[model samples]
Target: MTQKKSPQGGTFKKFIVVMVIILIIALGFTGLNYYLKYFGPNVTGKQEYLYIHTGASFNDVFKTIKDEGIVKDSTTFYWSAQNMNYVNRVKPGRYHLHEGMSNRKLINMLASGTQEPVTLSFHDLRQKEQFAGFVAKKIEPDSASIIHLLDSAAYLQQYGFTPDNVYTMFLPNSYQLYWNTTPEKFFKRMYANYEKFWTPARKAKAAAINLDPIKVSILASLVDAEALHDDEMPTIAGLYLNRLNKGMKLESDPTVIFAENDFTIHRVLTRYLSINSPYNTYLHTGLPPGPIMMPSVNAVNAVLDYQKNDYIYMCAKEDFSGYHNFATNIADHLANAHKYQQALNERNIKR
Candidate 1:
């Protein structure tokens, strides 16, 4: 009779204990899901890919890559890549990183032996020989072979480039391409880019100015190096245009400086200014043999947009803020020169 009076409260207590056990199990599973998605590293292993890029953040790379009908899961990728120290491994260039690349897989791809490549950057290149040399250094091309091709008219004609014609083939812009791109293919791409930029409209405008496109590009290179201000581009372009029209020497100090290649000149002495190098516009009456540097598109365009005027002489003002004095007569030019010289003296700038 007393056993029958067992409290219903005990039964409720038993149910409560079971429920607590179930909740703990469910919570454990949830926590594991979170850890795998966010905390686990090395999610992918041994997957090959075409490429990754330098400066690409952990998130950006995962977003761009495509897989077989399913992209890599971003949540898993970021955590895994980060944990495996895959940051800062992206290089520039076109790559064919293989499928299912692990963190180790990707890191190995960026190693020196990795076939993946970054974009090609030309650093302050001045001559065709320099470009050829850079190509040789970066790629597997023999320097002698490329140099021979550069010097050979017949060989270059296949690439639509004439011998000694640096202006028609390469533009000073970065190109992203496959690492294994052949030299012939590289030049083809470079030439195509060159043609695409120098449209017929540009050619006709160049002719209308009575300036040879090649020669104007040569002068534009010089003006680009000399003019510090974007606004000064056309004015400097026009100054050279005027000098060319009036049959006067360019008399650009930058040209003389480039010829000297050393900034140690206490001053541009009459002798140094009169140096006989082809780049010395003070020596020759016109533009140099070719561009002194790969010119920007703006500088090249300025040669076509050169304003017509009687200004045959120009000199930078003492302020050095990119403004210049334009002079049509020798007296005004001399006076401007005197003022600039005085400023130089006061500032104690060695020439």
Candidate 2:
């Protein structure tokens, strides 16, 4: 009204205003779509982990995610992954899933190969097969693969280990490792840990006791098997060491059971002792060729720092209290053995 604008000018101004409003609406819609596709919550809370195995293709990963219902929207995740260049960066691992993770966050984690570690702990595993089976359950390698490496004499020679003695390298403790670790890497890590455990002081102690690290572990396995209670480990270790020093047989019942390869034998009989095997401590004068079982840290330390005692024989107490009666003379040892045998008879634990 102030300038007496023409009708044509007024029409042009309205058209321009309309066009600007349409452009603004379109821009806002695009922005919202972009945010939803990239930063919106996409991962679900149903799954705890998404295992992307090694040598998996992008298609495999996507299929697993969809099949496991790991993500809320498969299309949005694929879109975001493609746009963020994550499709070509597939990494294999055990990835931890969180509730309500954004597509960008999840994609970035996967692309960068950030994965959770597996906590592995083992103890008292009897044989390499059992150990391999237990470890196979924790890691990516199969039990057969692990056993192959454990039995490979040529491969173990590089580590200064044999098929028999290689079992000693795996110390019983909790370890942090990647779930996809190969069998070779597992052995390397275990050997490194074994080296760390056998410190200079421990080696000196072993040498002073006229035993090497491997021999200490072998003896420790016996001590670990014989002692039902931790407090009696040093005493049992000392008794065996005394026998070793005197050139007498170890005569360990556990060794006899091990030689027989029958763990169900509650009471080792005379026939079990006569089994012709190197592990039969009754027949073999020195320590067995290898550890009969995985020795505990306490058992290993007990062997290294054995108690000073003249006791050369040990028999389980007749009270079945998991303690032993130790003796230096054969007569007293026979009496202890007889009492224990009578107790076993009363309990009807034959064979």
Candidate 3:
């Protein structure tokens, strides 16, 4: 049998061995390429965030990623995206980009729509327009869109608020929200938070003071403007409540300044009081129609738990301590006012 070994058989055996070796080499090369394209580091550069706008096409998204120079090799990313079917599954959102991210990881993230939430926060925003601007900076909606909603009486009315009092709905705090949240949705979320803040206990307190939640916020704005110290808020609130109970004018300098729309006026004058705006508490014998500024929670709570006192008038202290001198009678208030006026004159704050 050894002498009869067929030459054809040996040639066939050698061919099979050669084919096996070629197949092994081809598979090794293919696997290496696949590993490099899918699992290897693709994302590069210092850019840390990617904002894919709504209705963005896959091509548009890829262009943004490429333009940001976030990927080390565009060709590998393109290949991986095509193979992984991410080209058809692109999701629009704000994504957190990281350096040295693998193609597989990035592709998975983009397709899954797992976005990084933005931390939205604001404090002491003076105007509805200003609040809109703050929100626009963190979200996809422009300031104009948010402002339009804020000023829309019909739209605001659905939330049980007029355009003037609608600004009271937003409570100052940090909120985790998506960057692409619509204006209406944003307003609803803020209103929900406002509702949560005005709990049963808080509402009961507001009722005890003969003020509604919005009225409490309105008065809180005044208290916040008047008191330089948190400890003094209850006292200042008490004085305002006393005036309200007696049907006396608020006569708050802050409200006068608000009426004049002059935030720069540090020293409100008798001339400012002549501005016949409803916000001019000197002319209007009650709380203003709206908040002059977004009051803090502490200020709102202060109004709810206002101290009981008979203080009908208050004048700023002459010492510039940001504290006020309280008085129950006109004569005592006049004396304190005269001293404060003297201090103001010394400082040349005539306006």
Candidate 4:
């Protein structure tokens, strides 16, 4: 309608449209790239965990990732980590790797220190060294470090424990703890649990039995070693208490075995009783200086609620039924011992 469109103006309009299309394409590509980098799957399909040690540097973490092949694209992960500022916020812990996890999520977890806890359960551990080794397997501290603290008399004085008796503080149970917990913190947590377990009611029961909490635990260890059946715990505990009351030696075969540090002995021999160690109950009166093994809650409770009985002796039944024959006189105990010895001889279990 108007005058014929100017050629120059028409060309300028076409140029403007082409520029807009190019800009849109570039923007779209950039947005797609960013979305893929930030939100796309980066973790590998292999199910595994990342253990970042305490005091680990970001470089160490990155090296572990590369070595373990935890991520599909290391370049993208490194870029994402830098962008998220996770390089400086590295937290040591145990992190679970999920298949198809994005770098953003992984970085966020590591930065926030949202780590999975280790569920630690132990029982029948016989020595502090063994317990330390077992705990070290689940946590960050090495067995040597843990043993150092356990053996430190000055350090354990605050917790009312000695190197010999410290083993009693670790009650056998499942505990939830971070894998990066230090050795000192682990001991503190265990002491807190030990205190919690010795409630007012339990303390009162222990007092009634003329035993403090530590003594109760030491006796409980003996009870646990002697009784293979839980139902027999109270009776065995009662028998031991009777012997204690009579000022007689505990004469626990388990104590002798522990003194000799020979767990392979099926039948405790006469010679094993002569071991000069303080743990030899047949030679040393009262409970041993420490627990022969980690005491179970059942064993501890059995000691607290021991049956009132006059039985002062116990010998394993000859039937191999894991039960004991109780007696109030030496003659009856000798008879039971004879039967058990005969059974052992028949089985050729001399040790």
317 Cα displacement, candidate 3 (Å) = 1.4
TM-score of each: 0.64, 0.97, 0.95, 0.97
Predictions in order: lDDT: 0.68, 0.93, 0.91, 0.93
After superposing candidate 3, which stretches have Cα over 4 Å from the reference?
A: 1-12
Sort the predicted structures by TM-score, highest score first: 4, 2, 3, 1
User: Which candidate number would show the highest TM-score if scored against the true structure?
Assistant: 4
lDDT of 3 at 32: 95
The alpha-carbon root-mean-square deviation between model 4 and the true structure, to one decimal in Å, is: 1.3
lDDT of 1 by residue, 146-243 (tens): 67767788877776556645643566677776655666777778778877987889889988878656666777787787777767888889888888
lDDT of 2 by residue, 171-284 (tens): 999999998899999999999999999999999999998999999999999999999998899989998999999999999999999888889998888877789999999898
Q: Residues 1-351, candidate 3: write the lDDT tens digits.
A: 358889999999999999999999999999999999999988885688889898998899889888888899988999889999998998878999888899999999999999999999898888888888888999999999999988899999889998889878988899999998889889889999999999999999999988899999999999998988999999999999999999999999999888888799988888888898889898888999999999988899899999999999999999999999999999999999999999999999977
Q: Report the error of model 2 at residue 164, Å.
A: 0.4
lDDT of 1 at 211: 69
lDDT of 3: 0.91
- The 10 consecutive residues of candidate 2 with the worst lDDT sum are 1-10
